[model samples]
Target chain A: MENFTTKASAQPLKNADELIDSVETFIFDCDGVIWKGDKLIDGVPQTLDMLRSRGKRLVFVTNNSTKSRKQYGKKFETLGLDVSEEEIFASSFAAAAYLKSIDFPKDKKVYVVGEDGILKELELAGFQYLGGPDDGGKKIELKPGFLMEHDKDVGAVVVGFDRYLNYYKVQYGTLCIRENPGCLFIATNRDAVTHLTDAQEWAGGGSMVGAFIGSTQREPLVVGKPSTFMMDYLANKFGILKSQICMVGDRLDTDILFGQNGGCKTLLVLSGVTSLSMLQSPSNSIQPDFYTNKISDFLSLKAAAV
Target chain B: MENFTTKASAQPLKNADELIDSVETFIFDCDGVIWKGDKLIDGVPQTLDMLRSRGKRLVFVTNNSTKSRKQYGKKFETLGLDVSEEEIFASSFAAAAYLKSIDFPKDKKVYVVGEDGILKELELAGFQYLGGPDDGGKKIELKPGFLMEHDKDVGAVVVGFDRYLNYYKVQYGTLCIRENPGCLFIATNRDAVTHLTDAQEWAGGGSMVGAFIGSTQREPLVVGKPSTFMMDYLANKFGILKSQICMVGDRLDTDILFGQNGGCKTLLVLSGVTSLSMLQSPSNSIQPDFYTNKISDFLSLKAAAV
Candidate 1:
C-alpha cells in the first residue's frame, strides 16, 4: 500500500502501466465510462476482464437512482458485460441502507415521490408505503395514503426521480415537512439534469428537494457519491483499503472529487464530463491524478510486481 | 389620510361593513379572489363594480409569475371583469422595474429562465436577452450578450420560471455569477408553489432561483409581494401614502405579513391558503385587521359616514 502526499503536484501519469502499478481496487462510474445512454462503450468488457485477470476487485457505483442494482445487472448482461448485482452500488440502495442503519421505525409510514426501485428497497428494509393510486372493482377514491396518515406520523420523507410530479405532491410533501420540522428528509442524488439524446433534460427530484430546503430552511443529508457516508459504506462493505483504491469516472465534480476527498487515487475518463480541455486548466478544487481517453484504455495495464 | 395606533387587545371587526369602513384602498390577491385556475371567481364583476362605485382604488398583486400584467388583463376580460393592465402588479414586473430605476445597464444581457411575459418586459425596458434556444435548435446556449462590452457587463442574472430549464443554463448562469461576484441576482418571487388545476404546482421561477442559491451559497434580492421592494414600487407608482393604503391577500405569510412589515393595513381573505383556525394558533406571525370570506363579501359594504 502507498500513500500519496496531498501536496504532490497533479501531473499526467505516463501510461496505464505506470498508473495501475500501485492501485489494488478499481471503482468505476456507470453512466458514461461503462456505457453511454444505454449503449456500452467499446472494449469496456475486455477492460473489466483484464482487471479481474490481474487480481483487481471492481465495483460499479452510480449517482443515478432511476434504476436498481438488479436492473443495472440485467442491463450490463444485455450489453454483453460480465457483472453481478452485488458488484453494483446505487444511490437508491444507499438511501435505503442509510435509513435502515438509523434504526428507522418499520411501522412508521414513508411518503415517496419515486418509482418501484426505491419503494421495493424501502419495503424490503421493513418500512411501510403510503402514496399512489390503486385499482379496485368498486368506486375509486384518491386516498392520500401515507401522505394523510404521516402528515402527522411521518418519520422520514424520501425523495427520488418522479417524472409525474405535480403541485399536490409538492404541497403535501412540503406541508408534511413543515408540520414535522425534525422529520428526516433525504434525496438520492443532487443532479439537476441528465444528458439525453445529446441534450439536457429536466430530472425533477434534485430540484424538488431543493424546494423543500427553501421552504423549511433546513439542509438535507445527501446519501450518494461525493458524500463521505457513501464512501465509508463502500469501504466497509468490500473490505478494501482506501489507499489502494482507484476511482475511475467521467465526471470531475462527483467521481474524481469523491476519490480526492476519500483518500483514493483518481483517473479521469474523457468519455463523460471532464474533457481534455477542462483538465488542462485545473482549479485548486478540481484536479484528477491521471487522465485516460476512456475506461477501455486501462485494459493494456498489468499489475505492479509484488 | 388617517392613522391608528396598534392597540394591544383590539378585536376584529364583527362584519364586512365595519371592516370596509375602517379601510380605504383595497389590495387584492390575484389568484383565488379575482380568478381561480384561469377562471375568474364567481360574482367578481359585480363585486369590483360595487367597490368602484364607493370610490375605492384597487391594486391586483400576485406572487405567481407565470403571467404578467398584459396577460392578466386579458384573463380578467375573458372572465368578465373590466380592468386595465396598469392596475396589475406581478413580482416579475416589480423586479425588472426596480432594477431599471436603479440604472442597472439597460443594454447589458440577462439570462432569463421564466415566462414570455418577463422576457417581453425586460426587452421593453431595453435589457438584452442571452438565454434560450440557439439558432441551430440543437441545444440551449448560455451566451451572455454583454460579457466583454463593458467592465461591469452581465449586469444582472434575473431568475423567473422556465419549464424548459436544464443543466447548461444553470451551470453557465452560476459560472457568470461566480466570476462577477458583484453582479446582481434578482428573484421574481419565492412562493414555493402556485395553485393550478385545483392543486399546488411548482412555482417555476421560484424553485430554480432557490437552486442557484443552494449551489452558489448566495441569496438573491427577492422582489415579490412580501418584500419591501414591492411596497416601495407600489407607493411610488401609485403616488399614495404607504400608511393610507391597505394590503389585501388570501395568504397570511405573504399578504398580512407584507402589510405588517410595510406600514399598511392588512386584510385576510379566507378564499385561498390561510384558514381562520390556522390564524388562532399562537405561533403565527401575521395578524390581519379585517377578515372576510372573499373580496365579494367586502364589496357588499357601504362607506361609513365621516
Candidate 2:
C-alpha cells in the first residue's frame, strides 16, 4: 500500500485501470460526487456500473440528516440507481447508532432538534423520542410572566438538518443542556452549507447545531463525516479494511477529511461545493490522494484506455 | 483621582461618601442591578434618587435588545422608577446608532433577525427595514425543487434577542451576508442567556447570531455592552468623560468588561446573575473595582456614614 497519508500534494489521477486494481472498496459521498440534487450528473451511472463490474464494494455516505436510509433508498430508485439500504450510511442513522453503541439508558427519552429522518431512525432503533417537527409550530410567547418548561427525562439532544428550526426548539434544547443533569449534545454534522436544490445553496445542519453550541457554551459529539464515527461503523459493519477503501467526494472539510481521519485513500471531485481553484489554493491544507473533475472522469479515463 | 484599574482583588466597597464625591456620572446596567425581571431590586429607586439628589448624572445601559428605549421607559414607569427615555441606552438603540455612525446607505435596506424592538429603533432612526417579526411566521418548505430567494438590496443584517427567531430568518440573514456583496452583519449583544421572566433563563441573541456565524463563516460587528459602541455613544451624548463615569452592574463578562474596556470605574452587584463565589473564583479574570451584595448596599453604606 502507498503512503498516501504523507503525500502533501494531490496528484491528477491517471491510469484508471491501475488505480481500480489497487482499491477493493469505494466509499462515495452522494450530494456532489454522485448527483446534483435530483438531476444525476453525466456518466455517474456508467462510472458506478463500471465499479460494480470490477467487483468493487460500494457504500454511499452522506452528511445530510434530513432523510432516513429507507427514504434515501427510494431517492436512489428514483434516480435509477440500484442501491440497497445496507450500503447507505446517512447521518440520521449514525445518530441512532451512536446512542445504541453507547447503550443509552432505555428509560430516558431522546430530545430531537431535527426532522422526520432523525425521528424515524430513533424509532427504528427502539428509542423513545420527542421534539422534532412537532415543535416546529410551537412558539415562545415570551409574555411578561412567561416561563418555558422542558421535559426532565431527556437524556440526549440530537441536532441535525432541520428546516423547521425555531426559537422554541432552540430554547427547549438549551434548557435540557443547561438544566437537565448529565444530558448529551450530539450533532449530525458541521457542514456549513448543503445543496437543498440545484437553484441555490441553503444553510446547512451546522448552522442549526451552532445555535445549540452558542446557547449551551459546549461542543457537541459529532456523529457524521470528519468525526470517523461513521467510518468506524461502516468498517465494522462491512468487514472492510481501511487500506482498501477509497473515499470519493466533493467537499474537502467533510469527505476528504473523513477519509484522511480514517486512514483511507481520498479522491476530490470538483462537481460539488468546491472549485478547482479552491482545492489548489495555497491556504487549502486538506489534500486528497487524487484530484479529478468529477466521478465520471474515471469512466472517461477507462474509455480512453479502451 | 484614585487609579482603580490595577486593583489585584475586588475590595468590599468602603467609604461610600468618598466614592460618591469622586464620580460625577454613573452608568448602570438595568437587569440585575435595578431589577431581576419585572420586580425591581430593593432600594434601587432610593439609590437612584440619592444619586440624583447629589447632582450625579445617571444613565441606564442594558444588553437586552428585546425592548427599545421607549418600551424600556414604560417598563421603568411600571416599576415606579423615574428613568426617562434619555437616560436609557438599550442594545436595540445601539444597533441603529451604529448604523448612523457608519453612515450606512439609505437606499440599501436593513434585514433584521430580531424582535420589534430592533425594527422600531431602525424605523425611528429613519432607516428602511425588512425581515424580523414579519419573517417569524415564514418557514422553509425544503421540497425537492425548492430554491430559497433573498433580497439583493439588503445592506445589513442586524441580529438581536428575538423570541420569534426561525430558520427562515437565519437562512435569509445567511444569504444576505454570503450572496449580497458588502452586506454587513451586526449583532446587538452576544449575551449567552437572558431573563425573559423571573422564573427561568432563556437562550439569548448569541444563539440566533451563532446560526449566521456558522452559515456565513463571518463575524458580526457587535453594538452592545463590552463592545464600547454603547459606551462611546453614551459618553458623547451626555458630555461626560470615561474616567468620571462609574459603571455598576452584576455580570462580569458584559457590564464589568464594558466598564473596563471603556476606561470607566466598575462596581459589581450580586442581585442579578453573578454570585459572590463565581466572582471570587480563581479563574475569574474580569475584576470590578468594588463588590457589593446588591445595589441597595450603597444606600446602607451612606446611612451608616451618617
Every candidate's lDDT? 0.67, 0.88
Question: What TM-scores does chain A show, candidate by candidate in order?
Answer: 0.85, 0.95
* Tens-digit per-residue lDDT, B85-201, candidate 2: 998999999999999999999999999998888988999999999998898888678677887888899999998888887778888899999999999999998877888877888
Q: Which residue pairs collide, candidate 1?
A: A130-A146, A167-B200, B114-B161, B160-B205, B161-B205
lDDT of 1 at A101: 81
Provide the DockQ value for model 1.
0.12
Badly placed stretches (over 4 Å) of model 1 are A1-9, A15-21, A132-153, A180-182, A196-204, A214-217, A282-284, A300-306, B1-60, B64-88, B92-188, B193-223, B226-232, B239-306
TM-score of 1: 0.63
A1-306: candidate 1 lDDT, tens digit per residue: 123244444565456766665888888988779987667888888888888888888889887676778876887899988898888888877788898888887867777755566776776677886552110011212332212223577777776655433334444556666676567888776665544333323333565566556655566788776775677787888777898899988887678777877888898888886678787665635677887788776654332222
For candidate 2, write residues A170-245 as lDDT tens digits: 9999999888999999999988898877788888898999888878888999999889998888888888889889
Positional deviation of B58 in candidate 1, in angstroms? 6.3
Q: Which DockQ value does candidate 2 get? A: 0.64
**Which lDDT tens digits does candidate 1 get at residues B212-270?**
67445578888886777877787887787777777877777677777767788777777
